[model samples]
Target: LPAPILRLAAVLITSGLLILGCDENQQGFLLTNRPIVYLGDISYVVYLAHWPTIILWKSVSDSTSLSIFGIFNCLLITFKISIVAHHTIEQFFIRSKVKAVSIVVSLIYGLLAIGLMFNVPATVNTSVASRAASVDVAAAIEWNERVSHNAYRQHRPCKECLDDPEGQRMRGGYTGKGDRFECIWKPDKANGSVKILIIGNSVAHLAISILKPVIEENFPQVELVRLYSMPACRPTEVVQYVCPPYHKALPKQVQAMKPDITMIMYDDAILFITSSKIGQERKILKKTFNKYKV
Candidate 1:
């Protein structure tokens, strides 16, 4: 249970396993196996590519969990890909005959990356004026500038935050505020700011961080935000809710806190058992904010 005991147990178990691995035939089989040796040769390549491959696979499949067999199959597929790339892409470029072709390929890849980094759309939308009504170009520019700074020093892309059409719409900026809960030196304008309460599922988690800085820049007058969310706990007033008991009591708690503008962000996933009641939730939200209207 303790750290030192856990370490000792792990070492003992590993030592026992190593001592038990006395089968020379098993070792010889692995050493001589053609497929195993082939995979071993490109293990480093598989190491380099497997993580990104798994991430891409998860994203494309929209899968949160994979079985043991599924993981094995995924890794097998990745190994196959690694072997192919090692022969075709990596070795082909290294050959003297393909040196110029490699340069051209590299240039094309570089240009494509540069285009995405600058958000160069493949097709231009000519409706400038109507689109301008929707986007905060200045805020977007500021976000792009601060993206690298925001990623905790490691260079990472914020495509979902800055590039996506859905993401742009969600950055509507906080229109509310409240009293300082924890900041050390609260500004004098804090009391004057509109208090915002965001209640939803894990979607609120993304909305919270992504929207915070943009809201601060857009509404200099408003400064307070409170977010409460759980992964599967969609807001609903139905009799059979899968939400935590604490979460079920949050509406009454919000009534007591008296936020100025309450945003009821909900997952719109279709469900037969329990659905997030957006309209009824909106009515509840109205009632919560109405207390502070005076």
Candidate 2:
């Protein structure tokens, strides 16, 4: 038989046994008497009250573990509360004809819970967007500087920041600093051409070798200035941290080099983690791009 049917059969069999065992007076059973019935009633109280009690306790304490002593304490408190609530609250409510009040209260509580659940995503999105819009490029740059200095204290060179010399030689002898870096290709100082600034993290930086040839072949006479950072630094950080001070200052750096195109790149996974505060980084990136847009 199906599981539900099997479970129903079991319950029916057990109930039949209990009824059969009951005395003609219906005051006692074959297994025990009034004391056993009372104990069973208290056991039901304990089972019903234990879970919510534990949840509330954990929420307040921020604790998940229960030692032997803790378990004893919990049981003591649970039993005391359940006994009082059962007598003063549960029995009163059960005995009362308050069906209408109970139904209305339950409906209100369920509706409120559902409303809060729907509102969560909208709240998160708005908060993230507002935070992003407020980010100042200068402020972000300063934060990055502090973070980078602290990171250096850990005494490990981020391998992602190192340049691949073999990859560089194979692409063509373009000179640049770091493991993944960008160098501008200028034909002449006086000649005006479309400037392309490529920005991204390490993987995007490596792809620059492939991109350089394509750009050169397709768009001849256009000057290409590559701006890149390592690992998974977002474009906002590239502007604030890596590019400014390290690569050179932003507008001044771009203007002096004079480019027509700015290619911004980075790992989407990295951006998702670091740029959780929606608008700030995106705004900074767009602002920087607009400054250099031709």
Candidate 3:
């Protein structure tokens, strides 16, 4: 179902529940029973207090698990806190005749709650400050400066090569083409280059960065080639929003380049597309491998 349809269904269901709640004949029903009514009255306070109480208790007590006694005590504490909050905070606002005074008080309480929510976490875990103190800022700054110049080695973005699937810009301007998203790294000293095509998103780009030195050390003649891979553009013919055109273009590009080795490293999009037929994935893989063959 589409998102709009799902949203409409949710709205209809909630409206139905509201209609039922308003019906006097449904007073004896589970939702309208005395205990349920009282719970509903205090539910707002429970929503505000329960998780924070549990988290604060866990941090202070240094215990992840609660025994039966501990569980009972936690519930008791929560109940007591909720009851106090319901009477003092909730009822005070509800019963107060002065609307402006109530709004001001509520806003003040809300601001206090927001302040505590952010500040309490930092205060609770003092080690966050210690971790910040431990970071070597000078070393980090120096490393950043060194790698900042070579940042282009990660990924190239070019507007001119968008329409041309066969177009590629080789490193060192070996091929006089648009300096586009496609990148081909060739060895300087080697006479011949073994093209290794990488197909995927940022994972493929980062892999190239990490593997470049290792490949250069072991096989100086190897070249690392990367195509313009959008984040979710898996090599397979998966039905995704940003996929169809890129998917169709990929095999043609692979066939044209005829790289000696092809490396396909998709992002987390694979998890979503895994529901697709395994045979379909295999079929795409076989086709891509066939194109890689010289």
Which candidate leads in lDDT? Answer: 3
Using TM-score as the measure, the top candidate is 3
Could you tell which candidate, 1 or 3, scores higher by TM-score? 3
lDDT (tens digit, per residue) of candidate 3 on 1-294: 334675899799768867878887874595647776798799889888888887777555433334345456777889899999998978877877798667878999999899798897667577675677877978987767533424533433322112332343222212212221355555555444455566764445444554454554555555444444444344553323334455555666666666666667644322111213233433443454334211
Worst 10 residues of 2 by lDDT: 152-161
Q: How does candidate 2 score on lDDT?
A: 0.50
What's model 1's TM-score? 0.32
Which segments of model 3 are wrong by more than 4 Å?
A: 1-127, 138-181, 220-224, 236-239, 242-245, 267-294
Q: Each candidate's TM vs. the true structure? A: 0.32, 0.28, 0.41
Quote the lDDT for 29 in model 1: 69
Full-model lDDT for every candidate: 0.50, 0.50, 0.55
> Looking at model 1, how many pairs of residues clash?
4
Q: Which stretches of candidate 1 lie over 4 Å from their true place?
A: 1-28, 55-77, 89-136, 141-227, 230-294
In angstroms, the error of model 1 at 271 is 4.2
lDDT tens digits, residues 127-180, model 2? 987888867968888756634523432322222223334323423444334443
Candidate 2, residue 29: Cα displacement in angstroms equals: 5.9
In candidate 1, what are the lDDT values of residues 1-294, reduced to their tens digit? Answer: 334675899799757645544666566766677876776667677888888877876555433334345466788888888988888776666574667886878999999999888766633444554567778878987766544223322221122222122211232321112210111111233434455556654444444454454454444444455554444345553322234353445555465546555655544332122124334434443444334311
